[model samples]
Target: MDGIFDMLILGAGPAGISAALTAHARGRSALVLSSDPMNTPLARAPRIDNYPGLPGMSGRELLAAMGESLEEQGISRVTGRATAVAPFGGTFMVSAEQDVYRARTLILAVGAQQGAKPFPGEAELLGRGVSYCATCDGMLYRGKRVAVLGLGAAGEKDAAFLERVGCQVLYLGPTQAKKCEIKGTDRVTGLVADGEEYPVEGVFILRDTVAASVLLPGLAMEGGHITVGADMAASVPGVFAAGDCTGRPYQIARAVGQGNIAALAADAYMRKEQEKQK
Candidate 1:
């Protein structure tokens, strides 16, 4: 687990699994991370016909087949929601709760960010008083009150961790989170929820899927999709994006195709990097 991976794909959907398969074929060590593999949108689809060679197959069936493929290929899978991805030296650091992974190349196939939009000042005050990982930033608010807007089990764990860290935690379940508002100047100061305001130093927003932009800072985005080139390489070097997070035409075939391209692109990037390091 301490060894740096050649490619770290975020998500276990068709795109991510495809990327991992390709990476393995290319002889690269790849890791696939997903918080809730069972909850992937693909798994919810009753039937998919557009994908060739798999007519009349259920989404979950296809997903299971891909899982089996990964197992056969010996690709590693990790069950954790990635909170942040930051550049570290010539590689990258991916943080997921208590674990941190290092990779020379990154493939953001984490599907699309769904549900509620960001609150009024959430984006602008991201580092100031807003955070996604309670474990990563909870200690900064020690002895201070903070609001945790959690979506599922991951969010619940984040809130509990904040409490354990000595932060007076205000747990706003998913339903209440949608009605919450962040209010502050220069930094987070209060949270508005359910027609009531509570004083807090920071607000932690934890959800199953994180936006591509939020996951990797400085990555170019176009209307909620990660900007990519013809080779599937993202704006950031050593980073690639595929599937729904890349753009429209949300089809299984499209996602799988993009995942293939991303895997190849990552392999090429890693080769160039290794050559430079020599």
Candidate 2:
């Protein structure tokens, strides 16, 4: 529990920034974790006119301003594609880039653009033969044949770990055809990529993120979006969700407002817990 942060936010866009700022303002230590090419959908937008006080600013420009605000607020941002999140001892442990960080509460401002569907049977075989964290599960498949589907740099790094762990690794880059299907009856025996078959014992689908439900196991979701209440609290206690991951509209202002609400809710949750301890 040492070095645990009060709040760990998992995005750098409007929603994440808003949440970090709010948590900081409320005297909570916060860190924003995100992967490279952060906030891509917003970063690539040509222009955003609807956001108040920043009319005509491109997504890049708006993000720059937000970055400055974060610096002024003393919020540290980290670049890592978190692949797993789990609850432990009433806190959360986030696994990313072969490292783990712990937080008392979490704010999920990650966008909804979770890339690529899982290969068939991948979800079912999770923990059976499919995995996301090589650092966590690579040893289980050590000295065995495994397939690494690298969706981001983390995948490449993890693949190397798999190799070092004595596994026969099949490294597949992101550019490889998106057509991947996991093959097995009870456990992953192989996979099919771009209509080609691979005889392997396991598959590691390394991406910037696993779905919220996959990350926490019990996070209630609807229509592929994380379900949140009026306060932006997810079905999972001690966690709040906002931004595009929550659902429709997907506007910058909506995301920001929801982020603010989520942060406020998170702050209150932490306060209540602290009081309980006292």
Candidate 3:
């Protein structure tokens, strides 16, 4: 809904919140983009016993604390899942459901892996009839049959919207999302639902967290994690990564430390770029 920001952190968990706090401290404006905490792994962590001074706290407590810190610092936030990211004119444009945000620098703090591995044929068919955001691509499928694969209410909403847009919608719930497979060649031919085939021209995937690779294409990854250097700089020049999304030792402390590094690194990068222009 807003225009542009100095930085856009793609999670509200430890790493994300930490990055936003650090960026704001360094005089950089940042926006936190995240889905509902109640649906994330952090919210389900039974107990966190090793977070330095904040030991033996429940997962929800730690999440709440981070949120409070972000708000106290006056950093703005958007509660939604980012479906895709595009690098344009040296800036990154992130598509989160119905909203699009642009930022000079990007931070990937999406905790851990999300959603099941992309459905078979899903990647190859992406943008070739398979899409992640309904509002972004629904118009392309107008008057055609399409299948909606999603894990939450968001999926149903997207399906309904498609119907309103003139597309015949096949609404598959979360249980079906886990079992269905994408069927297509040059494009999305259809979807195989629970062993039954339903022909469609498009498929929309609605998940709380889309895969990191899907978010920013060609984002270097190591062992299923975003690859980053000592500076927390991601392979993408204007992008940085932190926390579990970057690798192992998935601890709150690790996430917080990395988040801080990412924020500082992003600020430094922007400053260096400004110098280049001068």
Candidate 4:
């Protein structure tokens, strides 16, 4: 329980599970954080006829195969929605419900993302201090301060990105304020355990950011598609989004393919960081 992971993959669909397998194969300690099966689009995708290696299979059948692979490989599966990512100390923090997951690197394999919450201030603050992509906002806090209200690899990585940008990051909760690592009046002042109030200029909420549907709106979305840069990475760093979430070719093969590439990019980034540490 005191150990930190080398990688934590989000979602347990084809993309996320694939990342977990890849990271584990490379000798990295990894975990897959996911919401319930009922929450994923795959659950609704009754038939799947496009995946390679499998001419025809139901989404459920494919999901089961992947699930079996995860078990066969001994990768831990944390069934919960990742609400936020942040940096705490030199490691990353992820928030989901009452649980807290940590890691050194992250892989966002959330495909066809969506937001499930419809609350006030949720939409207005997204990416305006309230962010989903840690790589994008991490640098914005250079030599400054920020607050991340999330848990798990997502929140931990987001906070790590903030730290990368020189931001004194404070972690809230993917659950609620009282259960957070940091708490204050209406805003986070400092780490609760440390009891030191650090000035904060922004607070990124992870509460409503789990599915591709929710994350889609905040991205460079046109109708439903996400615009990508040359490298297929989003405008955010440490955050390379692919799969159906990009809203481009909505096919199983494409999602699986993009997921593989994204995993590689994330792996490469983590390796680079490891090299720097060496």
Candidate 5:
């Protein structure tokens, strides 16, 4: 698909969907890549009370309504996990498992970064020998021994890709140890799992969600949340954030409001970029 969008939104929850709606309403092309079902956490909740006009409805009901709205509006959504987002030629490039997308602006509305409990030496060896995206960094370890701690289907797919690329892949399944250690002096040398050590050149920790910092290098964060201003613009230029990923007050109404702000900010940023080009 040679699709180039005006705004590329990560996450399909209220924030991401709302951002898409706003962008589209403003006559901008938008695409959303969502791995999780729309607001899975919210859908599991028995009821939500704070979101006005949709009061007392079950979370699942609210999610269904949101889905229908997005469908009615003809918003495009790609059901894949985004591995990385990189700046390219004043725009952005988003990489999923099977495809890459281009956009002039980006919105990081991917809810919260869950299930990223750090392993020993994981932080220190980041980019040295430890990585989050196998698809993005797998080639760096071609023909080298690597350990992949995968959480779900995405992890399995990453491991398979590594194997296909001639890398010796030691895939540790869905069960991740709470305290596995990445052992090495300068770079990643091995991984200690369940009290056993396996010599490896790199460790790829593939989970469903990743820290924003890992997704876009140099994207500023505060205490695990993507730092955003009142307009929902993030520390990185041309990037905006909304929903739980931006931080708490984790309410549906708040998420939707922030999503609107982020979309408007992205629209303004795109206009500025266009003017500069002209």
Candidate 6:
């Protein structure tokens, strides 16, 4: 396959970065794929307060440190969402909207998205009155009172999309009190702050991410998690899973640990393939 990576790690957080660094250190071509607002959970943590060495450091600080390490390692970064991974000939290709990245081995470090705070009607009316992806279901509430339940870029974009569709869009997020940078009127309503609720026919949770499911197929997902084997391989071969996307115990250190192990396994698998060729 053309434009294939020897190893392509999805997500830019701790796990993805760690795996890319390790693969690079081993002299394997590696690329990290991530979307915007890269910090994710680390950016939201009130403070680190834990995780060794940086006892008092904030989560954002730790995240920055890790990001710096990846940069120092000369690891390449691709800003795109992984929509799916499929076996292509003898290698794997991670698909995004713009292009398809090939990798003999893949590391799914795409971390779990941040949890959503459901309002009174948010959960009760799911599908009926709530949604997560505007791209997926924006047309459902055309010309209706639809609220975007997030303040991040994704939320803002969703609001814009809804507004374009002639839906009454309300912007809501963690910092909804702050004046919004996104501009729209008529179909788009202003934001509703954190402590308040808005009367909308539907609330879309667009908190800063492209849903991971959009990228992978046949994923063993249960409640927004992909199952991984002991070696961190998903049910699929030549593919490994790590970090929060693998499920609970969503800690930076744990993600780093999983990334390291997954890299080793991928490396070993590649070596075996080379030997088989001989």
Best by TM-score: 3
lDDT by residue for model 1 (11-40), tens: 999899999999999999999988878877
TM-score of 2: 0.86
How do these models rank on lDDT, best leading?
A: 3, 1, 2, 5, 6, 4
- The 0-to-1 C-alpha lDDT of every candidate, in the order given, reads 0.87, 0.86, 0.88, 0.63, 0.85, 0.71
Please count the clashing residue pairs in each candidate, in the order shown: 0, 0, 0, 27, 0, 3
TM-score, every prediction:
0.88, 0.86, 0.90, 0.61, 0.84, 0.68
* lDDT, candidate 6, 1-278, per-residue tens: 25667888888888888888888878888888887534477777867765777777776777788888888888888776554467888888776644778889889887886542233433334455555567767888898887776645666776888899889876666565342222123332322444454555666766545344544556566677768888888777788888998888888889988998888888888899889999
Cα deviation at 62, candidate 3, in Å, is 1.5
Candidate 2 residue 204 Cα shift, in angstroms, is 2.6
**Candidate 2 lDDT tens digits, 56-112:** 999988988988899998898888777778899999999885788999999988888
Q: Which is the winner by TM-score between candidate 2 and candidate 4?
A: 2
Ranking 1 against 4 by lDDT, winner: 1
What is the per-residue lDDT of model 4 for residues 151-259, given as tens digits with 9 covering 90 to 100?
4345666666677767777776555443323334454343332344445656665532354334333445545445555444654455555566666566666666666
Candidates 1 and 2 compared by lDDT, better number? 1
Candidate 5 global CA lDDT score: 0.85
Task: State the lDDT at 245 in candidate 4.
Answer: 62
Q: Which residue ranges in model 6 land beyond 4 Å of their true spot? A: 37-39, 114-152, 158-207, 210-214
TM-score comparison, 3 vs 6, better candidate = 3
